[model samples]
Target: MMVRSLIDIFSAKAFEIDPLHFQDDDIHMKQALVLKQVKHVLHKLISEDPLESLYMVDIIQRLGIEHHFEEEIEAALQKQHTYLTDFSSNHKLYEVALPFRLLRQRGHYVRAEVFDCLKCNQREFTEKYGEDVKGLLALYEATQLGVEGEDSLAVAGYLSYKLLHAWLTRHKEHHQAMYVANTLQHPLHHGLSRFNDRSIFLSDFKIKNEWKCLEELAEINSCIVRFMNQNEIIQVYEWWKDLGLAKEGEFGRYEPLKWYMWPMACFTDPSFSNQRIELTKSISLVYIIDDIFDVYSTLDQLTLFTHAIRRWELVGTEQLPDFMRTCATAVYDITEDFASKIHQKHGLNPIHTLKKSWVRLLNAFLEEAHWLNSGELPKAQEYLNNGIVSTGVHVVLIHAFFLLADTVTKETIAILDDIPDIIHSVAKILRLSDDLEGAKSKDQNGLDGSYLDCYMNEHQQVSAEDAQSHAAQLISNEWKRLNLQILTPNPFSSSFLIFASMLQEWYL
Candidate 1:
């Protein structure tokens, strides 16, 4: 599907779609002042209804303009947390779940047991609240945050999924049905882009005069992001053309624009243009390296390549194939340049740390390469234990932390070194999503074996359909772990959480 999607993107003519146009710069400048007033009016309006305040925060975030009013949103959530705690028993499912999700997403320490208040009534929830699709959707969204041993949420999530599916099937053409389907496809943290593409959210918020400003602001911000991203992508294409990496190998799957979308999704703010460019270049290199290991490289060549990465020096470049040499050189130069940027800006030398991440990434690749050659099928957990690292989440997080941090300290490095629960959870989700979707594909021979294959091999009685379902469940559970970890006290900057969430969108 990725290959087909890329082909469609590249094969299409530019003139097939209409170009986006906006007013002159002077007109946009005038609207900037209006935008400020709209933000103020929005803040004041949300301040009146605490529940609506939290809901609007969620909407603003989905609209991709939360950065404009971060302080105001933060203050509102903090106060809402206090108020919600005092009157905890008085709210409905939508009331409690909305604030809970918003707070935890912003790095607050809301407990999983907060949903304990709803556990005893789960059996009657659907029968009594079946018509409350909004509340059920909110409950379903909140359940995405379930951690280990949160039985209440596990049960609630199962019910919510079924109920929502039934509702969608019955009201297939309704707007609410469309919203539920979109939520199931991409949950809140990852669904912002798709949500913004539709007009429902805008119309829902346009009922009040003050919120009209917010709706307009979202439209303006979305346009800015679209324009900025298109220009940056053209620049990246020029850079990729100069490198000639795509022409050197037998592969035609090298898609720079597709790779750019991941980092662009992560850092949409105009301030991090450099980070987006740098991350895109590096991740594209990762895509190349992954293909080499999975398809092109022999076991002997992989060993040499892995050793070369571990050495982190150009001692054995001569032993590699022409393409591998090109890849290795690019990795070393790009990462070292990244480290240099950190050193120059923050006065901290991160060369070793950055290299360490690359070494670990390559080692994980080699581990899987070796496993594939041995004709031995490891258990699902064993493959996943190493497969998560191979997903490149850890390496990406390392770079993101250094690239976006205001200050780099020893404590921050230590926190990054620990492979916190958040990274693990993301890695798990990526691994499962990969296996689940890959199993459905007909082109399986040349690809690396997936977790679905491992599960099927281990349990001969389990059908492929069952195994796929199992993998889907694993992805959902890992999401819970990922959600829980973001709320824990941590040294990571909030930007890392946003990056992790963006990764969920990418891999899913």
Candidate 2:
């Protein structure tokens, strides 16, 4: 069976934006003025009581405007971290959980022991706290940030999930129920802030006089940001159209806007426009190359294509098939172009590193092709290990590091070269998620079998449902590992680390 095109699966109209909104000059001026007012308000709020600061910062982040005040948010969080020493039993679960989540998310260490005083036993929080739906929601959000061995957080997560579900059922019409429902589906920590529905918070804040300015700013900024992003998408879409690969090869998918959404979500700030565009180009190549390997090429043709990519040049392409040559040439040229831009701007040459990452990815794809041809099932662990690299996240991220990092030290390069735990964790999450989705879909038959198949093959008598459940548990374990990586010290910049987490969240 042929794989379905994303264009057939997703409605293009859903991604369309109105040109009239982009043409309005009045809105742009209002946005600037309102942005100034919002920054002033944020600075003042950060200087207020710690609890107020935490609440405001949370609001700012949820509104997707936190990038505008990173320094202020950092200072506020640092101050709040210092204030944690003075935290008392008088604080409600909501107060405690909010700070715990905000601080830990920003990489400020906070012990899970802070919840010990509120717990009635090792296994659960006090039953009385369950009545506080707002507190339960906060605890549920905080629990998402928990690392491995934080048994209390794990228990709190389960209890909060159950209690929140119960509360939502009873108060189905309550305004807060909307939040509970959304949080249950996509926890705040695991969600991409850029894609959050700001209108929900705006509606809630409209009732509060103190939050009027914030509401206004969030509203305007969201509109302006949407306009900016839509324009960028238009530009990328135009580039994709002109590339004519989808037209010429007639094999790969055509979804530049969809591909562009990944980097745009990862790097939300407007200044990263070039990085987003270039990364989208690279991503387009990934899909085209993937199609060549998975859907179109014969074994001999794939082996030759792999060899050409390993050679990393156009001189030897005469021996290759037409579609493979087109794909290979595009890959080589785009990679060279990215290296040139990096050299011009950052005065660094990562051409070799960039090319090597792609080679590794292609080799993994070829390995899978080899397995499918041989009709041999790989061990679950072996499949997962290769699938992590085959996910192509490393290539995307390695390209991102050069484009996004402020400084590229030998240590950081070494960490990246080693395929650090952070990258491995994220890659595994994406691979497993893709496999799970593939397991659910019938159209993915052309690909190598998934982890679910491998797991069941290895462990006989495990039902399909049981294998899926185990895959989900593996995904959850990866999330914990990723959370731990984000919180701990690493050679990566904070921007890169956050991007890694956001990318995984976007995939999930």
Candidate 3:
């Protein structure tokens, strides 16, 4: 049977997990923990009616009540570092005379530190980074404004919208803070290493509210640090002498799947269904899969394998592989089959769009192999080929997403049409930009140069924008059409902002 993550089954909306990753587990584990914890708690509270788990909101209130009393007592006792005084002052920093919370809520009662993290972090930031850290605290508070835009929030009326913005805004703040923390004191260059401690310098480098980008920046920083250390390079973080170290709080972990080919749990959209998480999943999958292809498979065999999954399903014990392949094949079948079943169960259209897309992607992968014979340095525009070089394991991740999207109801598809376009556009632009960067380089040691085959003794200049004279251009055109669909109508939304920002980073 197909075992879905609890997060997948519950249809969570944002970044909450079952148990947070141990202080700082892999991001995937952290994602699963938050989602599972949320779903589990909600399931417990509502028992027979998990959908009505809004009752848990009262628990937050109750927690707030006790927290408030504790705060008063703490203040009366002349406590300086408690949450109440800090968050309250942080609120005041914004020039808003509003109470720390809208009501009589307090710190003692809220459910431990999980639900009240922004407040906890607010206090921590004030105590450590100084009260001047109000910009982040302000961003946290700003989510309280009337939540507009999304139809779901619109239908929820004002109160629930406020609650949602409260949480979503907090998440945005967490990502922003993490971006700052991981990037701080990390050198972009050797000469620049000495300036890492400059707070003014740090102020200029920031990752915005979007989860994916911040997560990526943090991961890349860690990867580079590890790579440098392995080579015995000078440490970048040595400059923080006498500056009080930032206290470590719990971050999340990665929950590895049975199939290494499957995505890291972290990228699963807080609200992903069969369709959307594919984009995020691809953020990891492209590179991993590229590695597999580069090191493992041949072109013809990969094509055969692609064709197999299009119709493959686990039938009985008889068809299983003897070892790890069985597990991977099982997951591969389950992800695709579950998506097909969900649509079938709901009487949704049987498009099999994902399967079709995967076949196309597989063919694209195979085509890249042939380009090895093309006698030219592959550029970024050769996306189907360079998924390994730029995006890495995420190249074929859209196949999973396409499956999930097809499974969702047409209403959801309509609402989330922007997602697919965002994925394709970002992937395409990044691929080209990365390749062009390599083509333009003389050093040939960095990202651009490392991927460039400088001495292609027999050269063919395939147009960066066009895959080929025939079949490739059609596919490219279709991809562009999808992007155009996203950019039309409401082009300035958050989804678009992510799309545009990633494009800007990849390109000019």
Candidate 4:
């Protein structure tokens, strides 16, 4: 069907359709007619054919569910209002979109195909005609999305599109990318993009996101699995499996689910363990030296689906599956080792109540993930929603906080309570550092902000520099602030201090 073919031609340039450029309404009418016909073809297949069994199902979902939403159309309409000012052509699209959504929701599978058809045609229209003739096509595309948090979808789609476009330009393979980067095509991550292309084109650049590292990790995993003792991988897996992680199909196939398996994936990889693997690798020291990137992650720029444990504890975990628990404990042990090394040398007692608090934190993270996965959290404010802080990677934050706290309600489990407060402080500093990093990148022309900014801005003294990168002195000052908060600073806590110390070096 033309719907699938049109999938190869889509993105921002296609959806911003303008109608005033054409004086005759007939043109708009004709465009609408073609879209309707294309919809008819798609409707036949979706309604009557065995499309679910086909790989094209991915493509169909993208076009139907991801791209076409009522709010998507509204946002596009707002953009259109700016250009057309008083144009009614875009209204034609809304008329088409409502019925499309209803059909799809009702499981009128074949009729729903019309929406996908409209999206494909509109994408083609935008590519060919720009904003001038995109009217019904743009509406058709936008209306396929959900009304709730419609703006987020736009933001994410735009950002992904921008990065993917970058990767495509770098590789100079526009045609193949056309389909691979087609946002209207559904299964957003399944497609290729500028991020993928750029990372591949410049593999040597220390990347700032998990996905960026994914391809490398995969290669690393294969090598690690091949060379290392399967027994070693199996050992960790068995331990985790026994502890309630490492089982397949436990995670429900989303962001949290992905992170639940990350540590294991890394461990299973032989290449990843080799320090020579690139620069450093004590696979056991999963300090996830790399994910430090999460401190300032953002969806529009870049987002790390993992975080936490690096701070103090996991967010919500009421339903945190055993698989995630196993995953969390294993990785926390690895990362905490480094933190403990720092803590011991400095005379600070790293939070040792992980065993006691694991249940509480894991429960919180499970709830957080469930909420996030279910879309209960509105803004994804990690501090506010806890779940916002990297649903799965709470393993990292909880562990980090475990090493940082002075004391918690020792009444029940000594030192465990201090963790929540310590996590806030750490999350605050990290947020500042990240915000600076993000703002700095925006200044430099292609960097995404980190999680650190949000917290830093919430409390504490935040100083904005003309230069986006964090100043060494300022970061030190923040650390000193923390030190002042605690009278007996851990004299041995210099390594994690390494994280703060390296701010200037990493970003500047």
- Global lDDT of each model? 0.75, 0.78, 0.34, 0.34
Best by lDDT: 2
Candidate 2 has what TM-score? 0.91
| TM-score of model number 1 | 0.89
Candidate 2 clashing pairs, residues 3+ apart or interchain: none
**Tens digit per residue, CA lDDT, model 2, 276-317:** 888888877877778778888888888888888898976766
Which scores greater on lDDT, model 2 or model 4?
A: 2
Candidate 3 per-residue lDDT, tens place, 72-173, comes to 333322221233443423333322211222221111211111113233333453453342333333233322221123222122222222333444455656
Query: Highest TM-score, which number?
Result: 2
Candidate with more favorable, higher lDDT: 1 or 2: 2
* lDDT for predicted candidate 2 compared with the true structure: 0.78
Writing each residue's lDDT as its tens digit, candidate 4 over 136-205 gives 2233333333322244323333433444445556655544444434433432222222112333223322
Clashes of each: 0, 0, 49, 76
Judge candidate 3 at residue 494 and give its lDDT: 31
RMSD of each: 3.3, 3.3, 19.1, 24.7
Which pairs of residues clash in candidate 1, taking residues 3 or more apart in a chain or in different chains?
none
Of the two candidates 2 and 3, the one with more favorable TM-score, higher being better, is 2
